[model samples]
Target: MLKHSQIWRAIDRLAESKGLSPSGLARRAGLDSTTFNKSKRTTREGKPRWPSTESIAKILQATNTSLAEFTALVEGDGIGRPAPQTLPLIGFAQAGQAGYFDDAGWPVGAGWDEIRTPEVTDPHAYALEVSGDSMQPVYRDGDILVVAPDEAPRRGDRVVVRTMEGEVMVKELLRLSEKRVELKSLNPVHDDRSLAREQVEWIARVLWVSQ
Candidate 1:
């Protein structure tokens, strides 16, 4: 039997996968903004209130998702259930320090915090909290950036590059070649840099950011 909490969690996950809040999802489904609000999950008398099939159908349509995909969500296989997806989170300042990441630019060792995020394709993806104003305008301090080490960054994509010398930077890719790569800093105050491909320990693509 389907539990109330499980179904509600599946809705929550559906919203997250589309990068929308619960209220956003409800609005997109042509319902009241508070339809899926946590407070509405139960009645005034504290009895659990379940989402109607009609509402679920509306949401699935709004998200351009199929019933099978929604069912997979309910089963915790597509995106959301009760349990959360955990990712290693580290501050940008601390990330520059040694021992936090392996030579391949994947998170390793200790001094790392865990954050629960929605399902992503890359199992090795990690989160980095912006600390300084170096990446302002586009990304501010306190923003969370999700990096996928296994994803190769294409030209014009934002990426995080770590050097063999322990220098870590977030920049936009201008050009890449067999021997070197050109990078443009997000902040105009910072000058663009070019590094030999050999000098870079690893370059990971920034998949998502929470402002």
Candidate 2:
């Protein structure tokens, strides 16, 4: 778990890296203008309130940050590392096709630049573009997801899992066992899937989504 202060500091660092004030960052992220205001960090009674997940997502999207990067920024270890390559933003429907991204996950074009992101402790952090409506309501057709490979899988956690056959999907982990894992979609119109453990090549918990 992350402390509230750490989260706030990360937000501040992100703004600083971008040469903007906290309120400026909030505006860029499409959130309330007061989102990162120091006065809003705590209540008049001296209680603390953390930024909402939605707000964080907005900030990540506006800043081109991955979940891994944000986690590092919150921890306060250090900064000034090279930024992540700005990848192509594609819709989920295009995911099944070939040649969109390289094997290393870099977008296949010169139209890329680096964006400041918090450091991520999890070694397995990766980003994926949403593909289909099977994950609607919770995830739209074009949302970007950041998965944490080092995080333990648990019920109720959103995850990015790939089958041994090379198909990858994003969904919520509902149940897990030695034999199989059950995944449910956020959209009620989609039914759940249960896949045998042997069929999975990799599974990672989703830490954040930039919609």
Candidate 3:
């Protein structure tokens, strides 16, 4: 059972962790500054007004944090403070970085919008922000992508992968055999790539991308 007050506590903790005020956090999440304000938590008649799920999702997206991390904020876990970790946070054009983010679904930041996601029991599953239109026609700039590191991708599954030689790319997993994997780009203007299985360091199945 979810409690109403837990939402408030979560918001407070997230703001504090990000070194921002409630209003500042709201604004950063591209939400109304008053969305998390204490006054907004009540109605004119003094009835309790809980934060909307939409607003909460936006807040999470803006801060680059995952829902699981936000849960810790409410549980009073030690994660309320921000710690630097290499997680997949790429602009569409810059996603081609090397082994920069975790492939096993580690806890990314919080205060992010909830994009379309499949219900998974794993708490560390999360989405990353796309920066440019390079992955357009499939993924646009500012889009959020849901990634599941635990799932082994088969043929035709879109995935976020890092090459052992140091490069990250989000592409369709075209085919895979014992020794190699082939990938296709969403943009027709872009070409495809193939590599030996041993040359790949990690892969995460991309579940969704929200505009």
Candidate 4:
């Protein structure tokens, strides 16, 4: 669950990362200087008042930060920069081909290249070179998607799913039930998908995108 304190702390950390104060962040976002003031974080009765989604969006755009990165901050997932880590890399087009991944979706076999991603700690992590416009407006063509096959996919998390029919796709996980998994398309024009549990060969959480 997301907490109001986490959102505010993420804002503070974001401001600090950019060498700005809360007021400066707000101002840079074209919002009032007092928009993020500590005094306004609560009501007169002392209840927590969360920041507006619009405000968060504005600050993210102002800081040139990705939502995944910001979510990481909110979740406190990053623990400073660790040594660079290398992972097996393959193109999105090749993901559907056999021999690249095991039955459990872990990367395997030859024809795989290597990519260095900072702070990626998953030993089973792999990179997929995104192609085409099917996942645009979020993941662009040529963007590198870091996938953690070991991480469990949660609702609203970006994920990679491979069907038993040899199709690989990236979509937002919508719902997971005993019988089926629902996915929401990243591109508005693309239709959503619903796959039976048996039809889904594997599902992995997308940790982040390196654009």
The per-prediction CA RMSD against the true structure, in angstroms, equals 16.3, 14.9, 16.4, 15.2
Worst 10 residues of 4 by lDDT: 75-84
lDDT of 2 at 5: 60
Residue 140 in candidate 4, Cα distance off native in Å? 0.7
Return the TM-score for candidate 3, rounded to 2 decimals: 0.49
Question: What would the TM-scores of all predictions be?
Answer: 0.60, 0.48, 0.49, 0.61
Q: Model 2 TM-score?
A: 0.48
Residue-level error in angstroms, candidate 2, position 40 = 43
lDDT of 4 by residue, 64-182 (tens): 89999898877755421222378889999999999998766778899999987886644457999999988989989999999976455677989999999999999999987767789
The local distance difference test score of each candidate is 0.81, 0.65, 0.66, 0.81
Clashing pairs in 2: 69-118, 72-119, 73-118, 73-119, 92-130, 92-131
User: What are the per-residue Cα lDDT tens digits for candidate 2 across 129-194?
Assistant: 776577878887767776554355568888776676657677788877667778987778867889
| lDDT string, candidate 3, 119-161, tens digits | 5322345567876666779988778887755444667789987
lDDT of 2 at 81: 27
For candidate 4, give the lDDT of residue 147: 92
Structure candidate 4, residue pairs in collision: none
User: What lDDT does model 1 reach?
Assistant: 0.81
Clash counts for all predictions: 0, 6, 14, 0
